[model samples]
Target: MRSQQFLIFLLILKVNLKDVLLGFGNLKPGLKYSVLIFAVALPVMAYGSTLSDFSQYYPIWKPASDSTWNFILYESAIAIRMLATEFFYRGFLMWTLMEKMDERYANLIHSFVYMLMHIGKPPLEVPYSFIGGYVFAWVDLRSKSILPSFLIHFLGSLVFDLMIINQVFICL
Candidate 1:
């Protein structure tokens, strides 16, 4: 499991590197776009960190007894699960929806659906997910690429899952 997680992470890293290399000349423009992206992201992330119960919405601990192997397997499973989610939500869903409507409208609808997907989780998570969806959608729109959103989502999920597995956060 440890190997698998490491391998997946490496694969993502490689792809991102390739993209960076291919788009080196566009870095300045991309960074300019990312400014708006981060402007939207920062405040939400800051506010989210302040909630005492925010952690409850995430899975923060491993279900199995203490063991390195178990931890690796659990975390790896989480990474894989989140990767699939990114593919569905940010990749397929966003692309398909965008094709059917203007970017703004598509983003709004996509964010709403993304929030709906979290309905069964913690009550707080419902709102959080909605906000997160909007932020991610904005990033996608501004960057004109899904890569930025995917990176953010992947990292966020990693931290959320690690917090859950470590018992730093409890699920509702």
Candidate 2:
């Protein structure tokens, strides 16, 4: 089963190898990239704490009652979901909207769309998602790359998942 999965993954990877390589080639190196990454991540980390506090209002929002292995799998799945989300929202939607409108307007639209995407999530989460989307859109606009937003989104999700885990364990 593992081998089959690995083979399928490798096959998919091969198809996107050129785009992946080219994307990396286009990334700016050195201090500027590092600073942008920090700028993106630090706000998420700060705001994530507030989200964690807000999660307290929803006692049912904890992670599933699963084994360690299951939790790891869940975390991995969340990470993958976050990556796909960034690709869809920040990469595709933001890029397309920016092409059609001015930068400020596009970013506003992106943030609003991003907030709408979270309609099914807990109410407390919507505001943070809006703030995050705006920050990420701004970062993409200023940095001229999606990499920083991607990192920020991934790390933010990881932190949120961890918070869920902690809440679950505390309730136990």
- TM-scores vs. true structure, each candidate: 0.59, 0.63
Give the 10-residue window scoring lowest on summed lDDT in candidate 2.
Answer: 17-26
- Candidate 2 deviates by what RMSD? 6.8
Clashes of 1: 7
Our tally of clashes for model 2 stands at: 0
Q: Could you give candidate 1's per-residue lDDT for residues 1-172 as a string of tens digits?
A: 4545644764775644222221233244445555565566566655654565555554455353255566567667766666556555655566667668886787778789999988776567788787777776565555555555555666565544554444433432
List, residue by residue over 18-127, the lDDT tens digit for candidate 2.
Answer: 22221333345423554665566666655654664545542232443355565667667666666666655666567668768997887788889999987866675787
Model 2, residue pairs in steric clash: none
Clashes of each: 7, 0
Residue 108, model 2: Cα distance from true site in angstroms: 0.2
Q: Which stretches of candidate 1 lie over 4 Å from their true place?
A: 1-61, 161-172
How far residue 81's Cα lies from its native spot in candidate 1, in Å, is: 1.7
